[model samples]
Target: MKFAHEFKETLERECFPDHWLAAAIPYSQLKKCLKKVQRELESLGLDKETLQQLLAEQTVSPNGEPIPLVRYNLDHASSRSLRPCLSIFVHLRHGQVIDAALSPASRAFLQRLSGAHSRPSAIDSSACTTPLATPSPDVSSDDNDEDTEGELERIEVPLVFDGEFFNILQTDVDSLDALQQQEEKSMEAEIKSLGAEVSAVVGPPKRLAKSDLNRWREIFDLYVNAQVFFSSHELDHGSRSSVKAVQQLVWFQKQVQTRGLLQSFKVPSSAVAYSRFLQLNATLLQNLKFQEINKTAITKILKKFDKRTSLGASVTFRSAIRSRNFLAGSVAKKLCAQLSQEVVSTVPRAEDYDCPICFSIAWYPVRLRCSHLFCVRCVIKMQRENKKHCPLCRDEGVMNADLNNIDKSLEKFMKQYFRKETEEKQRANEIERGMEIFGDQYKHSSCVLM
Candidate 1:
């Protein structure tokens, strides 16, 4: 629906009280209504002159009477569209006090008119009209029901106006268009002035030799491609793997250097950049290598890089490619590359050792003093069971040597092995209980038959 129609419908649906729309009545009826309202104003304690002044300024139409001036063009000087408004004016009466009734625009005009003794009679007459004591129209039961159902029929009638509404509409449109056009021209001029100022500071764009420009573009493209690769690879690994993708990313640095991409970009060499890159790659690879990885570590690395980037460090551009610090950065990069390769190579191969406890693959096999290479779970269970001897070797007092400080590889195996044993035992007990219950039920049934 058109915005104007929608707005009108919304206003009607809200059902503003009679007081709000009381101004939309015929001028004659309005005058009659004013008299009664004036009396009510007097009863409210307003003096005679004040009441008259208020009555003269106020506008109110009689009950059930359509306004004589359907469309009011408020100001002749205002844009025609803006002047011809659809709002209704209202006058309020408090006891004997009669308030001046006027639409928002008309009120503003009245304020200006109040400074003068001899104001236009038309304005005064419009404000003070004859009073009508007609009773309000009663809605039919069916109409009331329909209103409750949220439906109201539109009553459209040509709005009676003193002058042509179309003329006012045209005038408003013209004025609005002129204002908008002027604004656009002003904006264009401002932009042109700004561009000239910026050009003066930056100097005219340099004209590079064709060959040099082409080479620079190629270098730029390489850096862009590398950034994209790193971003995608980082997302792919997201704490699910034993290999650090960042380490593999370091390998791309060689290509950047070999192609002289860095020198072309004029980036500064900083040890900090190299150090951070190495540290991040090291952390990632260490976790992967040790099989002691967590999502937090990966997230931390990303956060560090983000911080560095925010600090104006170029981690993924041609500038980063050229620095002397790049050589040091290569170590972490190489490690990442190697780690990635290891992951790919190991994918097809089955794990040689499995956790006896959890029965899953043992990443870091820890051997207990028992000489038994059970997964970490199995060792932990043995310790908890207070069995100092190795489950396999039966060596006594083995748990006394600070089990917490034991090698990670051995701990991993024992943990896994003991977990498997515990699960098996639990399953066996459950089965036994089930059998016992069934036997008792069978016995009870036989006794009942007897």
Candidate 2:
């Protein structure tokens, strides 16, 4: 299938809002412009073969150094404009060939361009500096400007469509960047508002017997387990693709429904907050799809441009066009970070307060001088064993922590957010202590016959 057709169809099918649709790259227009670029190059007798040979032509200096005869750069004069400069090494004398390696056609083309019409210019040592993998080398490396012969002249090829093509692309990229910024600000505001709304719905327990806080905690736990947009697994550590994001999002929604998490929302506002949260995620996914398709369009057009002109524009164009959120980073990565900091942090999770040594709630949490927390029982055992260093950081603060190390605030926090888990950990600690003191057959007093 033709990429242009596919691009057009996908744009229409995506049903993005009218403004977003309008802001998308004009792939068809760029394609038409690309044809002009091809024609313009061909008009100057610079077809794919001619240009490729010219670009690759090199000559050896008297000191046995290779001097590039031709250099092409997509000189970024400014962020708004990108121009292509083709600098060729040519002898000023009448008919002396600069490089014996260049074919007759390439040699003639170079002579013709270097003759009268094209103005001679010097290659700026800083002009070609970019992050390109295959950039044009700085030819002004010799101590003297002149080689053995009557000096080498540099010619700049004046190209119309080549510049036009990049201008169109770069302008679209800038526009898309602006749109993305606006969308990001809008989405961020929504996320912030949603965080507050969710916080209110799942706030600290109040007069209401069923305040929906526990339900929210459960929902957030499942949402976290879902790992919808990003994954932390060793196998897949980066942002998931839009398709994978869709699948994960669906799984999260299904889990909530299957577990009747939403159905059990005691607070009336909880349902509204949940609905808003789901919609925000959907919007992010929609933006992801739009960004992905447009990114594909840009790649296709650049590849086509390179294939048609043999100018090797794909690499140069990518380096020349600079964008912010649109072409650089994923919205998912940014928004997900914000979500974790703002929204998810509102409903405290048990993992955030777990003892590093036991991987469980740190009831009677003892905070060491190193600032690492551990369950009181684990610390007592460590002190009895004469273990001095902190388990996690290997700091010598473990022995320094005495009765004063017990974090009253953190203990209250654990009890408030993870009451059930903290209570169970306390019982487990009591059972272990009893078993250690009175053989394995001994049980905690709470479970023992009085």
Each candidate's TM vs. the true structure?
Answer: 0.15, 0.89
Spell out the clash pairs found in candidate 2.
Answer: none
RMSD of each: 29.8, 5.0
**How much does candidate 1 score in TM-score?**
0.15
Residues 1-450, model 2: lDDT tens digits: 898888888878878899998899999999999899888877766777766776677654333456666666787788579978765555544444456555666567767765544333443435542211111244452422343443455556667887788888898888889999999999999999999998887766655466877898888888898898899999999889999999999999999999999889888999999999899999999999989989999999989987887677788877767887788888888988998888988998888888888888887899998888898988988988999998888998767777899999887777677778988997898888888889999966664675
| CA lDDT, candidate 1, residue 145 | 43
lDDT of all the models against the reference? 0.35, 0.78
Instruction: Give a tens-digit lDDT track for model 1, residues 32-84.
Output: 33344334423433324432333344223433334432122232334233222
Residue 231, model 2: Cα distance from true site in angstroms:
1.3
Model 1 residue runs over 4 Å out of place are 1-247, 263-450
Cα error, candidate 2, residue 145 (Å): 19
Task: Name the candidate that leads on TM-score.
Answer: 2
CA lDDT, candidate 1, residue 405 = 37
